[model samples]
Target: MAIVSTSTSAFYERARAGMKDLRSQAETLQAQLGSGQKLTRSSDDPVAAARLRTLSRLESLSTIDKTNANRANADLTLADSAMSNMSNSIIRAQELATQAASTTLTHSQRAGIAEELAQIHDDLYALANSRDSSGHALFGGNNTGNAYTLDAGGNAQYIGSNTSAELPIGDGQSVTRSMTGRQLFNFTDANGNDTDVMATIKTLAAALTSGTADPAAAANDALGSLKTGLDTLSTAQTVVGTRLAWLDVVSERRTSLSELRSTEEADLGGTDIASTVAQLQQTLTVLEASQASFTKLSGLSLFDNLR
Candidate 1:
């Protein structure tokens, strides 16, 4: 009798442990169904979890790349617009210089034209010193000061850094966000002499108002310089266009890569609702059977059987 009682008690304990285990499994399946994500714990699926971590990191880096691309694009766009305006201003200067070159124009008439030229010079100076969204000089490379400033002699000079600003758009990709003042405005004339558009216009204005005996000669030289400046400006614009095109290509590639990472992450981390629900059903059925068996065992006692 003693041996039978001990055996029954051990059986009851074992049955209770099995019921608890089934309940725990049912709860886990239910939680997985609610969360819609399998392998909540690393132990559930280590390989998938590791892959998911890598994908998540890739997704984060992709977002940063996109932000850099947008900033670079915007800065380049601003530079392009400013270049167009500068080109138009240079063209107007050419027109004014052509008029001043006529021998028939009197000193007074040329002086009037010089005033307009002076205004154009100021406009070009301001345009060259344009700022970016962050209030830094857009054409000043990494320098925060104005790109073009007036010297004691009233000549426009480039005081900015020589290098253009660059932005990182990807893991190993970068692009120039802006052109330095020297790259866009300071160019060489046919005589191989370095010339800046603002200074060229200023010199023309001085010639018109100088009352030199050969004012027409100075006007002719001014016209040639203007032509050289135009050609140089066109070349710079082309460079900016090329960079913009490169940015577009980079943006497209980054977007495609981001989408691929997202797909991979979903495959690794996302749960299968149908399978989880089926598993929940099986767990609940086992748990119910275990509970019923446990209750029956609890009702049976050695004393009752002995009676």
Candidate 2:
């Protein structure tokens, strides 16, 4: 065989470089174990890192969607409760109207019933102007002000938008956040004339208190319109209930999607502890062996070998 020679310094340099590489590998594996992440930088796994970025962005958007859904849920729930109260008030008004329609009641007694009806009108107006969880008008649609405004004649007029605001709930879906006061309080009467609950009640109260030729006739006339108004209110309540149920479904879907994203995120970046620890242990063993060999070799000289 031909003689091959390497200088002591060159041999030492080669050994040190090999040891340095082994130590770097060991440190990398140790870091993976400590941090519980497979990637130290985007360059480590560009494809996975890009996917992770997309997932993170989606998570942020989903958070916003959840918040919006919660707000819509709260607003709709408030509207439902307020409408229930309104229904109760309408039922009470119907009872009073029945009492006023009786010819046996004295004029003073009919006047007392009219006073109660007027109070019910005021109560209904307050309910129509009920505030949402955010302190905004519940039945005002997107308007920040009261849903109904009082005119010079003391009549309640709808001042809100025709339709409520829609909120995004994720996956390209949206829901109307609330119903407008006009939708609940206003309806077509039996005579084909457009009328509102507040106006009808106000007129009936006035007729009763004014000592008209026939107070019972006025009360009888209002009964048909009040019944129609109550039907309208009940229908609106059903709509609100349906929307609330839809929100619940959307929320559950969002939660499932979020869980799926989390699972994908963990799969993409999370470190395998058992595999990383095994690699670290193997690297340390090799490094220790190399170090011991270098120490023994460096201490020996040609003269000492001969001796």
Candidate 3:
């Protein structure tokens, strides 16, 4: 194409010169903002950015998993504590029943023991209905709206499920946070054994409160209930202890995993201050020199001295 000599050419030249300088300034500013560090996108630094993006996603997932782990941990601890309390309360009731069963004790003394046993029963009922943080039933599992309700016969009925709520802890690992009242306090061990205990204690108490055929049967029966309950209580306590131990191991692993993930996140997302600063300074120097040279070249005119 033949070159056109008109104001259009001059304007084109001026525009091109301005655009070149503008482009240079933009690059300098971008370097300053980035501080020589690249963004986590394949377009920025394909290989590094891709790797960083993957790492960042993994870290995000791990963070969510940690939160889930924490929730599960809280629920499990609550269940463990509730189970422990039930074990203690039942054991105490058993002791009182044993005392009442003793032949050496007078009828009046047996009555006192029955009264104490009654209080223990009441306490057990309360513990069965225990609530956790946020007012959910601690031992009610996922159906935390209510813990224990009474049947028509006034016996405790578990209103929860067997499997406790679980939370994801990352890497395909999950943990259960809680067990319902039925699972922890009112299973075959807690409920089945307790039935006989109540029978024995009630019979003894009634006999002592009112004149009965014989003082011996009522008291002895109550003592039998006590012995059975103790055995059951021991088993229940061991379950709680085992669960707590598992939770502790998981908790330690959680802590270590968290620290490891944090370090990985730093590697993926954190800026390298020294390298970034140096790159920024170098770009600034080049931009300044370019601008000065462009200013001098653009200002030069062949006709200035002659005019």
Residue 217 of model 3 has an lDDT of 67
Clashes of each: 0, 0, 3
Cα error, residue 238 of model 1, in Å, equals 1.8
Per-model C-alpha lDDT, please?
0.88, 0.92, 0.63
Candidate 1 backbone collisions, by pair:
none
The worst-scoring run of ten residues by lDDT in candidate 3 lies at 182-191
RMSD of each: 2.5, 2.4, 4.9
Q: Residue 16 deviation, candidate 2, in Å?
A: 2.2
Per-residue alpha-carbon lDDT of candidate 3 for residues 1-307, written as tens digits (9 for 90 to 100): 2343564468558756765775665564465456534453457557666766676687688778767766666665765677677667767766665565567887678678767766676676677677766578776777756677767855556677666667777778766666555444432322355353333444555666675666666666656556665565556556656755765786687668768766755565556666656665776676667677756766766568689
Q: Which ten residues in a row have the lowest lDDT in candidate 1?
A: 262-271
TM values, all candidates: 0.90, 0.93, 0.72
- 106-203 per-residue lDDT for model 2 (tens digits): 98998899899999999999999999888888999889989999999999989998889899988899999889998998999988999988899999
For model 2, give the RMSD to the true fold.
2.4
lDDT of 2 at 240: 97
| TM-score: the better of candidates 2 and 3 | 2
